[model samples]
Target: MSIVTDNPFLRLSGAVQAEGIDLGVAAHYGNPMIEQRHLLAGTAIVDLSHRGVLSVSGPDRLIWLNSVATQRLDRLEPGESAETLLLDGTGRIEHDIRVLDDGTTTWLLVEAGELPGLHAWLDSMRFMLRVEVADRTAEFATIGSMAADPAAESASVRLAAAAPNGLPLVWHDPWAVVTRGGWQYAAPEGHPAADWRWSEVLVPREELVVLVARVESADSGVAGVLALEALRIAAWRPRRATEVDQKTIPHELDWLRSAVHLDKGCYRGQETVAKVHNLGHPPRRLVMLHLDGSDTVLPLHGDEVFAEKTRPEAEAGWRVVGAVTSAALHHELGPIALAVIKRAVPVSVPLEVHSHGEVVAASQVVVVPPGAGAAADVPRLPRLGVRGL
Candidate 1:
């Protein structure tokens, strides 16, 4: 069922319903390029109410959350925000959460589809802890924007100004920096997300209508999911639904840059995480694809990506190596996408994406490099019986 079935945003003319989360809003409000510019200029309001929110309260909230999540939150200050992940027993990412603490309650922002399961898991893990979990989705909605606006000095000020009801709790994205205890796989200086000044604010669900009206009345730009997705892909951001597969680990998506705390104490999949970072490479790597826009057939999610095989023993001229996770037509960059492929796929090779009996040419821009792990450079111990030279 779509979460926006009764959302007031549907009243906007030209609104289109997307599959997931029922993102029923004007995809562009008539000019997508303008909307993109608004986002970059910090003048856009993005409707992200499709996401879910959960509240954790009580004395043990912080400790209990820090124990289970990948990010360190034991010392999280009130109104401060962080990103974390919930991995399965094998270190595969199961849930990605944006966390915010407001002193009394901890707010967890998660994908709508994963909400029920994540809430249940947190409930089950609270065996003896004083933490109390409650679903805040019905009462709260999320609004996203870039933090680059010079007028608003802080997230609190911006959110408060936008919400007439009162100050809404905000969660600023931690992707811009390498948090303490986290490791960054991407180059520090040139990462696409380095300049991404993004933040999401939680507002009373009933206030969404008022917020939208204010934005439109002020001539402040408004963008939908399509615009946000394009900017995200262009910034090389990996979202859970697009970048993660069943076998995915944080290392595979370069999630260590912000989400994983390498030195954190034991969690569900910490051993596998440590082993992979110290001694092994992720089996797959994430890559950005600049799709050829001349053909007009953009590949969709799950479209098979193939590479031209050079060896004579190859059965076909091409071999299927990966699949497109997200594809978007950027207002400035045209058609672009993000894909996860076998780590062995040569970065030099021009890739092909097969969708609907059409082949779309794609060129790779490495995101997670082929050699993605063994970053710690742990020294190998000498043989037990051998003498040191």
Candidate 2:
């Protein structure tokens, strides 16, 4: 068997074909059904052998991590995992990951295929932090699931468990060790199990392979990339590289509530987060889009969205607040997308979601703090300087 490098999708029987990527010799034996089942019914084991896994060690690892990431890292107990953000100096997200605090070491699980870059980023920042970073993405295979599991939420880490049928339950989580069931998963040629990368329930990869595999298996090999895309759009989850814009501020994306610590001591992007929340408004707001069937394919990433007054509105449409980071045709909902709209647009007005030549219907999903939007005067906080300028 040829070694699988950056693209772990090649390991799956039909992922390469369904995705339409040329996998060279692997194309000779394609099984789309197996790929589909990995998403919907039985347990499908996927080799996310290509994801970026990093080990951040040293006595100062905790303090060093606490300073760079948005979450309060100093307090996480072993076996605990969380969705965390890496913010720019302005408090905007640079990257996001599922951070795991294994009793002795801290693992930064980044999107698949980004390990080398993340490793370099960690290295550049290692001026005097006493932290050492290593890329171990190729060391092990990771499996995942949204399948129903009776044993889920146990003493051990449960990645995800859900029952689709009345009595049919499935357990889903990525397994790090070796396995040879319906599917055979092996680390790219040279690597052995001992070099197994960080294995956990949380998904830190940028791509959808791990989650897709779990869904395919649980769904009896009937799940497809399209179905997973629909689920993601419905969940309103951020797609990291796609949904987050370079100029975007994290708080506007709701990172404060889900990804940041307001009361924690200063870090690099503290000032930006505080200033935006206290003195200014969010530049863009994340919104869900509904696409019409006029177009067969979903909108492309970075497509513009228009809110206009004329019948076949064009030049006068509202400039894009942000673009389509990710989109998919839903099984139940036809077509759907997640976009970042400018705050200036009225949330109540109906809008047109557009790609190069395609247009879709979109409505804003207003996200206000618990008691906000209902109150006459919204509360405010004072600003102060912290680690980030």
Which numbered prediction scores highest in lDDT against the true structure?
Answer: 1
Clashes of each: 0, 36
Which pairs clash (backbone N, Cα, C closer than 3 Å) in model 1? none
At residue 24, candidate 2 shows an lDDT of 23
**What is the C-alpha local distance difference test score of each model?**
0.81, 0.53
- Identify the candidate with maximal TM-score: 1
TM-score per candidate, in order? 0.91, 0.68
Measured on C-alpha atoms, candidate 2 has an lDDT of 0.53
Per-residue CA lDDT of candidate 1, range 241-294, in tens? 778889999988889988988887889999889999988999998899998887
**C-alpha lDDT of candidate 1 relative to the true structure:** 0.81
Score residue 129 of candidate 2 by CA lDDT: 79
